[model samples]
Target: MTEPLFKQIAALIEDSIVDGTLGIDQRAPSTNELATFHRINPATARKGIALLIKNGVLYKRRGIGMFVSAQASAIIQERRVAAFAATYVAPLIDESILLGFSRTDIHALLDQVAESRGLYE
Candidate 1:
């Protein structure tokens, strides 16, 4: 399913935060700039920005512009981790159950995959 425009915009900003393209107290693109750059409606961009502000990922200066919150990256990371579990881990477990795989089997399989990818060290 396609994500909503506002959510996509929010995700974009979150990604920027995670990747260090945006840092704490750094100014964010203006709503108009986001709208123009993404070819989206200004209102949609504003709504996305508002979500960040509400979630404490961003704050506004009196007249300067929006800036990343001091803890924006941490906030974004927490949200993304929760979302990842919901979006991927839950479904993987459900599918494994439907396929008659035991929990041990799943763990072993994951371990094997991680070893192959050099991630089990």
Candidate 2:
């Protein structure tokens, strides 16, 4: 299933923050800019920005613009980690159990997979 447009916009901003494309105190793209760039409605783009503000990933600067919060990247990273566990890890565990894999077996398999991907360092 596809994610909603607003959520996709939100994820785009989150990725920018996490990847250092956006820095703390830096202004985010305005609603107009976002709408233009993504070919989305201004309202839809605003909804996405609103999500970030509500989550403390962004803050308004009165008359200036929305800026990345000082801790935005860290917060985004934490949220993504939790989301990954829920979205992928839990399902993997459930499927492993259904396949008669023991906890140890799952752990070893995960280790092997990580090693193959050079992610086990």
Best by TM-score: 2
Report lDDT (CA) for all predictions: 0.94, 0.94
**Candidate 1 lDDT, tens digit per residue, 12-114?**
9988989999999999988999999999999999999999999999999979999999989888889889999999999999999999999899999999999
> 1-121 in candidate 2: lDDT tens per residue?
9999999999999999988999999999999999999999999999999999999999999999899999898888899999999999999989998999998999899899999999967
Off by over 4 Å in 1: 112-121
Output the lDDT of residue 35, model 2.
99
- Relative to the unseen true structure, what is the C-alpha lDDT of residue 72 in candidate 1, on a scale of 0 to 100? 96
lDDT of 2 at 42: 98
User: What RMSD value applies to candidate 1?
Assistant: 2.0
* Clash pairs (backbone) in predicted model 2: none
TM-score list, all predictions: 0.86, 0.90
